[model samples]
Target chain A: MGWTGRILAGAKFLAPLAVLLVLWPILIRAFNVNPQIFPDITAVARAGLESIRDGSLFAHMGASLARVAVGTVLAILVAVPLGVLMGVSPGVSAFLTPLLRFFSVLAGIAWIPIATLWFGYGFGAITFVIFNAVFFIVAYNTLLGVSTIPMQVRNAAASLGAGRWTMLAEVLLPGALPNIVTGVRTGLGFAWRGLIAAEIIATNIGLGYMIFVARDFYRTEVIVFGMIVIGALWLLIDRLLLAPVERATIERWGMVRSA
Target chain B: MKSLAIRNLSKTYFDAYAGAHVDAVRDVSLEVPEGEFVSIVGPSGCGKTTILNMVAGFIAPSSGEILVGDHAVAGPGPDRGVVFQSFALFPWKTVLENVAFGPKMRGVGKPERERIAREFLSLAGLSHAAERYPNELSGGMQQRVGVARALANEPDVLLMDEPFASVDAQTRMTLQEELTRIWQERRSTVLFITHDVPEAVFLANRVVVLSKGRVLEEVDIPLPRPRRWDALVESDDFKALANQVLQLVRSA
Candidate 1:
């Protein structure tokens, strides 16, 4: 991109955020809400300060991040290979697609009840929820990705002296990358929601638990503060990681038809 | 050694609902000698692509045989390279990587593969675009990478099925010239299929015209090489042959 384009893009991203910052004080004053029901900027700030001072914020954040990291990595490792294997044969793909879709539909927040029952309400249960959330969606997307690669391309690859393994590595995997990345983004989004929900219901620590615990004591400031942290964390991940990866794949692999 | 031989190669497709079998390519026989550039020009639906696909081992003949260097064709192998009409490049890979794919698949190590890929890239005049992915390059450049990839395998025969059909006329001319140059340098047996009469005349050592899924006639081009593009077009013989071939294609 040109310097002017880059600068304009940066400005566009920051403009709404700057406006939101400017409007914050007015919003707090106009609401006339109690500190216990809805925290003023100072109350939330003080809470944030207190949490940081006591190191509770770090501990919770670390636990949440660790769950996401472990769950997502495990899901990717299992889902991609299985999806590709199932996709190689049309009969297998046709047979398995409906089953996968059914499981993927049952992914995320819905898994909480069973996961808690199965793993007994702690890190294990939360991680299982996250893993199931990402796994089914990613596998479904990978299958779709591999299945949809143009047959002509596969024939072309084979005729150009590509063996079985080469066909899989060169044609199948790369062709499926855009869809796989898309699946990861969507799967991760569901997993994040499931994590939050699971933490609220089952875990003793983490951001969701923090909010739920605060709710019992009518600590609305803490709840509101936790919601902000969740939003900010998701924004950072999507913007900083997933969005760029998606953009790169689409731009690189998408066939642009000229008029 | 015979580069390629197809004996009574017949392929049938059954249309279940219609309760009739379609003979896509019926009893087609041809022998291509080593270092020959042969073009098969035919009408649409004359099973030109079906024949090419069978030779490439993408499909099997119902009752016939395909022999490459005395070995019966069972499946696609590295000995026969194919250039597809759509270019069919792996879009995610850079030009260098696409060209190197065949060598890499054959277990050639990185440094040697890169060096061989570089040679083919230069041969196709795409050395400058090595790092650029297929989507980023022009249609002409993408086809060039396809050619480079096919040649990198060092096959005994190169089968191109209307490789330039999707490109613009100007780009097609340049690619035709580049393909001719590559064929001359490597001397690989070529079985090229096209509907364009001029393209067949320009590139082939012998033009085998097909009509209604049969060989209508075979014309020895007798065009001398190293051929110059502008000069070949300006020649009276080239124009006459092109017209004769065009008439046959139109009639078919």
Candidate 2:
């Protein structure tokens, strides 16, 4: 709760990773594993440093992050309002629920082949995959969130003289925010994974591409380094960005047990 | 201040699947005079909440009309404020912001709204928690905020649907006393719904008892003003009034 307490808690999270790092080298020596199968810890570290020195690591990470950002932002901008619109009407929401569910299930990796065909295997195709991954889930979740607001709250707002616009702004939006933020977090997760898969299949740049290309040349060290970079990047994004946003929304809007 | 008049009001629900008609409230008529505190007490299925909701314009009567002042109630509007049993405070908003919501909806300026919110929050004894979100507060505190939010709208009539029913007994008592204090100062016409006989007797000038979707009795409370819960509950007059209503409900 305090600054020092938070710092200590953050350090506690690293304990498992620290143990894994320590075990990694010992396991490498004990097994006498072929380098082709798995690179040594030092080899992976050197590969990481080499990529960083050449600036390719930053370029790949930037490309991956940028695509996710652009695609997710665009998806959210379109999905949230549309979701709210559809959700406000029970008839519309009921009619569209099954359709949204179907599309959400078919999102992300399933769209990669069609997206590549449509956009000709480049940034456009990869961005499309990420967009597809984020869009349906966010929209469906937004619909769920908006529809779940208790009628009593809306009535309370209306009785207090909230007009259509006022109710939407003050009651509907704020009430549904906890759900919307959750949708964004989930959508981003799917989109992040989709972005990696799309990059591997279609794009010439990004963390996925870096690792996939390494596999062909027997560059297991580079592949391992890329995997670490991907994992670290995801952890940072989830912990620093999405998780905090989700936690704050839930804390602010959640039905907390009374103390 | 304007009185609330319910004229031959009725609500019937058609259960399509069951192929049956349910009369939630039947030919209910009552008058809550301006600045009067009226409580509707009833058994579980007596539709006390239906009457409250109708007055609040959340539900339309199948027949007859509800009038606040000279205006026939059309729909829910700022002229009437409702306090729900669940508190219904916006979880995302801070205490001050929740209180300010009504005034803000009515296009009050930001500074004026804040001042109005502060005044009501202080009246509710929640000024100390102005910045705290609804979820952070105790049930009583959140209900206090709910009271402030309703009052902040400056409605002609205050409609409360069992507002204190959800809280613990101790908190409910405190809230009842606090509500009486606030009502004494503001002199707003109030229609409070509750199942608890003692609560009805404690808060209302007149306690209306309902049974089977109909008015069973409306007993007047002659208890003196500035009533304290501890002292009032033990008094012979309070007990008599509560017992009378309790008997009506139990018999029905």
Candidate 3:
């Protein structure tokens, strides 16, 4: 869509959320709720301004974002190649799929105790949690992507004089790219959520720690402000980064029929 | 162009459902001289496709061998270019890139390969479609791209597996005439597999009718060059040959 069309769609999408924001203060006043129970919209806004002015919000956000970025990149670098290998070799995939499924079932948060014991608390532990969230899922998806390529296409490549490296580069990789992108998108979504939870237990400065510490002093406004920032950041990451990547792969390949 | 020869070729595999060995092709042999266009026409299950796959080295024969200028078939190679019925052009590639793929694999540099690819695309009447993706083209156009891709490799023998079977009748005729016109220029040895009798008579210098995995008979079309359905439609020679092949297929 063009700029004006995109802006209009953005406006339409935010309309309902704008209504909720307007209603929040009125509802708090009507109920005359205690500040400890839930902060008023104005109080939450003031707390958000204080954190920004003090630079604490930026510090927390930066740390969290860095961990996520490092962890996700590391996971992808390993996962994609491993998945392609598994896809090419059915025996290896069959042997490892059950093990992968078992580890995946143990969700990222479930690894916290062992992760801390192995790597100790802080960066090592938190990064391990994020890696766990992304790795198995991305690997599984990559395998699925590679296997879905038509056999005839591979045969065509071979008959065209493609050697092992050329076949992988020209046929296997591009053919499986759409599926690989989907895997990364989903895996990263989980990793983002897992990062927040891991940071609560494993780190001293991060979005999760920012909110969890507020509960100790009845700083309800700060807690609510942190929640909003967490939600908004995820929205930005998905919309600005992941969705475009997925769209590029699928649309560029004509993997999906155009509507 | 190189001659293609198949000797004592056979394929037999155990049918799981039948619990017995069933022969797919039985002791079949054939020869095509350099630059000859030969069509192998048969009904479904007559093993024409199986024989083509063996010659193209997609599958191994149970016995005997196939030779392309005295080199025995091993596996799929750049020496034998195949055109699939599905017109298996890479969807991710533009028309130019798809045609360039074979040369690219052979270590041809970018400018030289693109030049070669463009030459073949124009030969196939698809120069205007160089930047378009395969999915954007009609079925007939995609098949043309397939032909262009195979020819760009300049293989010793071209193997086509029902390349026009899925196209609509009107478009099929255009593609057939186009094939003949290109063949006249390139003169690549080709073994085309198809079920349609008139198409067999329309494109080939010689037609080999096959049934039950063996050769039924062979017929030659002395029809003059620059063959067109429009002109050949009225000729008694074309009808008699098509009828003769049709009868052989029916008898099998």
Candidate 4:
């Protein structure tokens, strides 16, 4: 597509969001809603500016993003190689697939209580939650991706003089990339939610912490501002970072015809 | 001397769940002289692909032996290049990169491999599409790239498994002509597998008819060289040979 077409596509995505923003303030005024229950648009905006001016908003954002980054990177580094190793052997993959699935299901929020107890309610506990959220899903996806490569492609590579290393680098890795990337996207999503939950329960500095602390003082404006920041930050991360990576991998490696 | 020899090769699959022994290919033997074009024609489930896979060393024969020149076939290697029915082009790689893959694996230098890949891509009539990924091309184009990739390895033999089966009839015919032209220029020994009788008759100097995991007949085609698709298909000799092969296949 041309530049104009891409710009139009971006505009199309933001149009609904623009409409929602316009409706929010009107709804609050029309209902005469209590500020304690839900702050008005002006109050939330002022709280947002105040936090930004005091530099607390940046600190919270940095803390949250850093934890997600460290946890997710660590998880990917460990999971991908292990998954590929397991996937290369049918017997091993079959034995471990159910186990991986079971753990993935029990990942993320479910581990929050135990993580806090083990790590004593700080960075370790929160990072552990995020790590748990990303690890199994990425591993499972990598395993599935490697296993699903057609035997013909592998045979073609082998017949063309591919050694073990060449097979892994050229055939296995590229073939499995679409699945691995998709795994990362999904795992990151779970990690994002887990980060928020962990921050609320265990940490003292993050968006989730900021909102949770505000709730005790009935500072609905601050809570509302923090919620908006969380939503916008997640949208940016997904759209700017994770989504594009997923899309590029799928387009480059997936066999689906490009439209 | 034959470029490839298969001696009483066989394969059997044991179905553990059903407790039954199934023979896929049984006591099949064939030989192809150097630079010869041979097509194996068989009905579905007649073990034609099994034989091809064995030749490619993707699968081991349950009995007997296969030899390429003086060496016993032990496993897949660069000596034989295989073109699959599915094309098997790596989607992530560009057309040129896919062709270069073999030479790269063999530890050829970057510049030399790229030059080899470019030459083969042009030979396949795809130099214009060197940068395009596999999914971006049509089925026929992808198969052409597959041919180029196999040829790029400079293998002693080319093993093709219904390489044009997935393309439309028109594209398949074009691809066949292109393949014949390329083969004429390169003079590589080819072993093509297909169920299409007309295709087999058109392409091969000898057609080996197989059925129920056994060789039924070996028919020679005395069709003249530099065969043109329109003229050859119109000739009485081509039709007669095709009909004879079709009859053999149907009866088998």
Candidate 5:
């Protein structure tokens, strides 16, 4: 679609959120809710402005985004090649499938407890949790993706003089890209939740910690503002980033099934 | 172009359903000389594909040697390019990229490989669709790319296994005619496999009929070059050659 068309679609998507924003303060005023219990829109906006002015919002956001970027990047780097190896060899896949399933089942926030014990609090522990959340899902999906490539296609590549590395780069990687992107989307979802949980328990600076700390002061505006930032950030990442990657790979390739 | 020689080729595999070993191909030997088109026709269970698979080095024979020129074939390589029944074009790659894959593998520069790709695509009558992906094309168009991909490699031998089997009859005929036209222009040594009798007879210089995993008969086709479905479909010579091969296939 053209730039204008995309902008129109983006505006349409955000309209519902805009309506909710408009309704939030109206309903809070109508109900006459106490500020201690729930913050009104203006109070939340004021809290957001205060945080921004103090640079605390940017600090927290930067910390969280860095941890997420490092953890997810490391997880993907290790996962995809391991997954492709497992996919290429049935013996390897069979042996690892059970272990992979077990870890995948135990992924995300569940790892936070031990991760804290192993790495202690703060960046290392929280990063480990985020990594746990992304690694298993992406690896499993990569395996699925690689294995799903048709045998005839492999043969064709081979006969056309594709060597080991060439086959992996030209044939296997592109073939598995759609599923890999899907895995990334789902894995990132889990990573975000795990990050928030880990941050609340471990880190002093982040959206989760900001919200958790506000509870002690009965600063419901700060808590609500932090929550809004968290949700909005996730929405932006999903819509602006992951959705376009999926469109480029899956939808463009016509690999998206009804299922 | 290099000649392909299959010596005492055989394949035996365990059949789990039957709980026994099944001899898929047995003691089959064939030769396609340089610049000649040879088609192997057979029934479904007669192991025509198995033999092709062996020659293409996708699978090893039970006991035999496959030679392309003086080089012994042990595994799939650029020397023996294959066009599968499924068309087997890389779904993610554009038609140009798919056709350019071989030269890219051979370490040709981007500009030269793309030039080769465009040349082959034009030869296949698909230059207009160069930037399109395989899924965007019809089955016939896909097979055309498949053929172009193999041909662009300039392999010593071009292996085709029922390359037009999935398309409609009309498209298949058109593909056959196009193939003959391309082969006439650039005579790469070819090994075509199919269950279709007329396809075997129409496309090959000689038709090798197979039954029960062995050579049933090898019928020579002295039919004129530049053969087309429109002119040859009803001609006595084409019918006689097709009928002769069909009877041999049915007799088994």
Candidate 6:
């Protein structure tokens, strides 16, 4: 795009942020809120600078990221193919779908109690929480993707001389790609939230722990800074990474409906 | 031995709404000769697609026999290629991959299969879009990929179900002509199904009119080779044949 188009798009994105910044002071004054309840923007900025200078921010962020990576990757590697297997047979899919749905509904936050009980308030518990947060959702989505592929496409592939293996590789996987990617996006969102909650509750060295530890000392500035960091990190991950991947996959493999 | 034969073919649905017994296609018999282009024209809900599905071995007949070259079709095999109306190309697959699917499925080696795919891709006039994904192409182009994919198997018989129904008027005309040209060159036995009379008359050497899951009449098109749509439009023979086919369909 031309510079004008780029400028317009940038402005479109920043407009909301600008409004939030302007409204922050009004919100603070209108409620007569103490600094302990909600720190001013400058205090939060100073806290952010201090954390970055001390390397605490990077350390916490890195630890959280690693746990999420290990958990989600392991989940995907196991869940997708298993989901496809269940999806291929209607009887299998029908039987398993309800079970998976039951598990998926009880995913993420609900697992924290049992996970902490079993794994004992550390990386193990946190990782387990993240894993299930992603696992059940991803597997369910993958099953939906595989099973919902139009029967006509399967028949078309069969008539085109595609064998069982070829049909799986060519028709089933490609046809289900859009749904699979969508599932990954949604599952990751849940996993991110679960990671933070697990870190606060069970772990001692991640971003969530940093915020929770700050709360013990009434360090409102640090808490506000951490919240900003969390929001910014998620924005970056979703906008720069997952959203683009989802859009590209949809454009590539999805049925494009012309307007 | 015919290229394809169906004897006492029947399909019944036993749903509550359809009642205990509802025969979709009842005791239909037909024979498709080798290297002949045959079109089956039928009214809506006439079970033409059910018959095609049975022949394609996607569905089994309720009670009857379906034979291709002395072999009873137990299930879908590489011998019969089907071109569907929906142009059901794998969206993730490029035109090349879609066309090469048959050979790939048959365990043909990569280099050989790719070469074979490229050749047929050219024959279908889709050589330029070989690298493009299915969603990136137009409806007509996608249908050509479907045709190329079917042809890749080099099947003894090709079955097309309303292949031109989804495309626009201009593309549909072009595709129909292209299909006839490809059929002439390949000389594969083709059973083309459509509800359009002109399309049936223009493409097939023999047109079978079907209504209520049974054959109404069969009309022979003796039009000369290299048939152009514009020239065929001017011919009295084309008009008369189209009229007769249309009348049969309307009455049905």
Local error of candidate 3 at A204, Å? 1.7
Winning candidate number (lDDT): 5
- Report the lDDT of model 4 for residue B72: 93
Give the residue spans of candidate 5 off by over 4 A. A1-8, A257-259
Question: Candidate 1 docking category?
Answer: medium
Residue-pair clashes per candidate: 0, 0, 0, 0, 0, 0
Query: Pairs clashing in candidate 6?
Result: none
Q: List the residue pairs that clash in candidate 4.
A: none
Q: What is the lDDT of residue A70 in candidate 5?
A: 92
Q: Summarize candidate 1's per-residue lDDT along A1-259 as a digit string, tens digits.
A: 6789978987998899889776876787898766776777777778888888999988888899889989999999999999999879888889989988998988587888888899998899999888998999899999999988888788877876677787888899888888899999998898888899999999999999999999999887788788889888987899889988887787788643321
Best by DockQ: 5
- lDDT for A242 in candidate 4 is 83
Per lDDT, what order, best first?
5, 3, 4, 2, 6, 1
Which one wins on TM-score? 5
Chain B TM-scores across candidates: 0.96, 0.98, 0.99, 0.98, 0.99, 0.97
True contacts recovered per prediction? 0.76, 0.92, 0.76, 0.84, 0.90, 0.82
Please state the error at residue A251 of candidate 3 in Å: 0.9
Model 2: per-residue Cα lDDT over B1-252, one tens digit each: 689999998999997988999999999999999999999999898999988988898888899899999899999999999999888778878889999999999889999999999999999988899999887888889999999999999999999999998899999998999999999998999999999989998999999999989998899998998989879867998888788888988997
The ten-residue window of minimal lDDT in model 1 chain B covers: B1-10
User: Tens-digit lDDT track for model 6 on A1-259?
Assistant: 4789878987999899999988997898888789988888778889999999999999999999999899989888888887889889889988899988888877597899999899998888988888897888888988998888888889988877778787788777777777778888888898988899889999889999999999999999998888888888988899889987888887777555431
DockQ for every model, please: 0.70, 0.79, 0.82, 0.78, 0.86, 0.71
**The 10-residue segment with the lowest total lDDT in model 4 chain B:** B1-10
Give the per-residue lDDT of model 1 (tens digit) for B162-225: 9999999999998998888878888889999998889999999888888877778888888888
Question: Evaluated on chain B only, what is the TM-score of candidate 1?
Answer: 0.96
Docking class of 2: medium
Error of 1 at A251 (Å): 2.4
Q: What are the interface RMSDs of all the models? A: 1.3, 0.9, 0.7, 0.9, 0.8, 1.3
Model 5 iRMS (Å) reads 0.8
Model 6's alpha-carbon lDDT is: 0.87
**Ranking of candidates on DockQ, top first:** 5, 3, 2, 4, 6, 1
Which portion of correct inter-chain contacts appears in model 6?
0.82
